[model samples]
Target: MSPTLRSIVCGVLGLTLSAAGSTAAAAATTIAGEAAPACVQYTAGWRYTFVSNGCDTVQQVTVEYRDGTAVPCRTAAPGETVTFPGYGTSGNEVLGVVLCGTTPA
Candidate 1:
């Protein structure tokens, strides 16, 4: 299997096992129609994982808070996975949007 696929699978498995008692399973969502057809987003607890879908371009991830504040996170190369830690605890009401960007490889 390709590195990207492997990474994505591992992330899914990890999330699945971790969220066994939850009503929903965290799944990877891909962003398409871009020049670089790569990027997956998923959140499990305080950890969010983004995976590249084999594009030559690199993927940049940013987290935008509910207060309209955005924080720059790590960048992941094609077929790689980058994880970001969510702020606050599970009991706290933390809302943030994860933005995925692509750059020319």
Candidate 2:
């Protein structure tokens, strides 16, 4: 598998397992920022609400998992409401998300 894909998978699996009830990592669970911090995973898919921004703005997203799997995603438009199910199992604090432009210059 590619390095990016591997990273995302590892991160997702790690989060999923911990969310189910891992006592050693109680402080690892995290959801940060306001107004759609781009690249945040639905790992465990909690009922999270955020103000949509840059609607109709096409964008690409790359997420790196704890184990180094990188998952790539994109939006057709800015400020779009996307529902990505099975994003990952929410079992710990989210590390971070990285966003990139969807279109080429």
Candidate 3:
């Protein structure tokens, strides 16, 4: 093949491969079937709230408050628990615990 034609072909092939690899990675992140229920637990106290990870794997969690604010994501190992202070007057109150992605802060 001519030099120019060969270079163009190689470039096209490289782009195709890169696109396919990225598509596969994106698909892998999507849940294929019913997602497993979150295994996180929480307890609200007067001054703080306790969040626990009951799953067998490490999990990232955020404490959601009744005021629609949430704490920064925290990582917890299996059977580990973490604490976050209550928010405003009337002790804001913990509304729920939510699973978070492993993205770095």
Best by TM-score: 3
Query: In model 1, which runs have C-alpha deviations exceeding 4 angstroms?
Result: 1-38, 47-56, 90-105
Candidate number with the higher lDDT (2 or 3): 3
Writing each residue's lDDT as its tens digit, candidate 2 over 1-105 gives: 999999999999999888665542322332222323543333324342222335345544433345543333434355454433223455423344445433331
What is the C-alpha lDDT profile of model 3 across 3-100, one tens digit per residue?
99999999999999998987665444432222224687887886777888889998767666777653556678999988877655675777677666
lDDT of residue 63 for candidate 2? 37
Q: What is the TM-score of each candidate against the true structure?
A: 0.37, 0.33, 0.56
Which of candidates 1 and 3 reaches a greater TM-score?
A: 3
Candidate 1: what lDDT? 0.47
- The local lDDT score (0 to 100) that residue 58 gets in candidate 1 is 66
List lDDT for all candidates, in order.
0.47, 0.42, 0.69
Candidate 1, 1-105: lDDT as tens digits: 999999999999999877763422211222222232324444535444333434466655554444443333456676776554554454432243344544432
State the lDDT at 5 in candidate 2: 100
Candidate 2: where is the Cα deviation over 4 Å?
A: 1-56, 85-93, 101-105
Query: Which residue ranges in model 3 land beyond 4 Å of their true spot?
Result: 1-38, 102-105
- Residue 94 deviation, candidate 1, in Å? 6.6
